[model samples]
Target: MRHKQVAYVLLRITIGVVFLFYGIGKFTMGRAVLVDGLVQQFAKTPLPPGLVRAFGNVIPFAEVILGFCVLFGVFTTMALALMGILLIALTFGMVLVPNPSIVANNLIYCVIVFLLLYLAEYNTFSLERLWKK
Candidate 1:
């Protein structure tokens, strides 16, 4: 039982780190660059440029906030749900762009988020759990 909890915690932290760093990297690269890159990538797709830009504008902040929440086990389930939603949106866009590689990778992320959601009840080591006690 303890090992299962530990495994869940490790997976949560690992996913959090990946999202946190990816978001940080985007900011480091400059928001305009990131948004522009996204715009260009989805340019030929049916997705509207404005919609893509709006999503891009929020992606970094959402990733950072959600990543922190998951990392520290604060509202872990809710954070994971939001993460799943984000991944779904990303996957949708990738499919429109027909980028098989990224869509595949995003699907993997979706699986991880789903696993995290399932293990949320075992999140006894989280800050929220500790605080509740």
Candidate 2:
């Protein structure tokens, strides 16, 4: 194997593990609480109440699925793209709400997501690799 392949594997493993852990954390903490908190947070914005609730309910599951895909190195590009988009939206939400704490948290996560994207070509170690075999 090449040095680039080694780097790819290492980055893919690290990013995959992190995403999986984050997704598990969301589920472990109780989805309803997470949903309610999101709803309340969004309620402060001009976004429709019903839409907020609906999105709140949907996000957790999406996170879990996306995390799983990343963890397993399946559909890596699509999974990373979706996660990136979600993080960007989250950053926007924090900005809109002007919550210092949330802004800090979202910013950190956004950076992580961006880093993952920056390293995405390294995901050649994933299913995409096997497919090429």
Candidate 3:
């Protein structure tokens, strides 16, 4: 295989595994707990409580979808962009909460997502081969 092909395969695998774990975590452990916390936090912000809860529920599905797309190398660029944006938003929220520990994780994930976005062209290894033709 070519260097580009190797890079593409690596990128796809890395992104897929990361997102798959994230989606599973979101659905199984983080969503409800984080949503309640977020509802409380957003209660102090300008955002409505209902909207906050709704966003919390929707975000997990979004992550799952994006993760699946990355795993399959489908719409690689768009999925990376979406993941990057979500990471950025998460980092921002962590900062606003003034939680140093959470902020650290968020920042790290944001950087990782950005790196993945930077390498999105190499995510051409999977089913997206048809899309390339």
Candidate 4:
């Protein structure tokens, strides 16, 4: 029980910090530069150009918000669910590019996020607990 709790918090914090790094870099890069990078990534995919554009715009912002939520353990279930969906979308993007490392990394993140969601009740150290008082 103690070990699982430790693993859950550790994974959540680790993934959150990684996402924060990725998300913050996008903001510093600016929209045009970031979207240009995203465009290059979506180049091989058959997804509609507009849809790809939309995702490129939204993903970074979503990551920043969701990453913070997970890191602070606030509304963790909702945050974890979004993280899972993001990972799924990212997995597809990675597979399209056939980038094995990103795909594996996204999969690993999804698994940890999902497992944490399942055992979220055991998360005693979360800021979420403060709401109960």
TM-score, every prediction: 0.97, 0.77, 0.77, 0.90
Off by over 4 Å in 2: none
Which of candidates 1 and 3 reaches a greater TM-score? Answer: 1
- Give per-residue CA lDDT, model 3, range 4-105, as digits (tens): 768767766676677777877878886889789789886666667897798788777888888888778787778878888877776666666567898887
The per-model lDDT (C-alpha) reads: 0.92, 0.74, 0.76, 0.84
Best by TM-score: 1
- Give the per-residue lDDT of model 1 (tens digit) for 1-133: 5998999989999999999889998999999999999999999998899999999999999999999999999988889999999999999998998999999999999999999898777788889988998
Cα RMSD (angstroms) for every candidate in the order listed: 1.0, 2.5, 2.7, 1.7
Clashes of each: 0, 0, 0, 0
TM-score of 2: 0.77
- For residues 80-129, what per-residue lDDT tens digits would candidate 2 score against the true structure? 78887887776777787767797787677667667667876666667667
Which of the predicted structures, 1 or 2, would earn the higher TM-score when compared with the native? 1
* Residue 81 local lDDT, model 4: 93
Per-residue lDDT value at 90 in model 2: 69
Q: Give the TM-score ranking, best first.
A: 1, 4, 2, 3
On a 0 to 1 TM-score scale, where does candidate 1 land against the true structure? 0.97
Off by over 4 Å in 3: 30-34, 41-47
Model 1, position 5: C-alpha lDDT score: 90
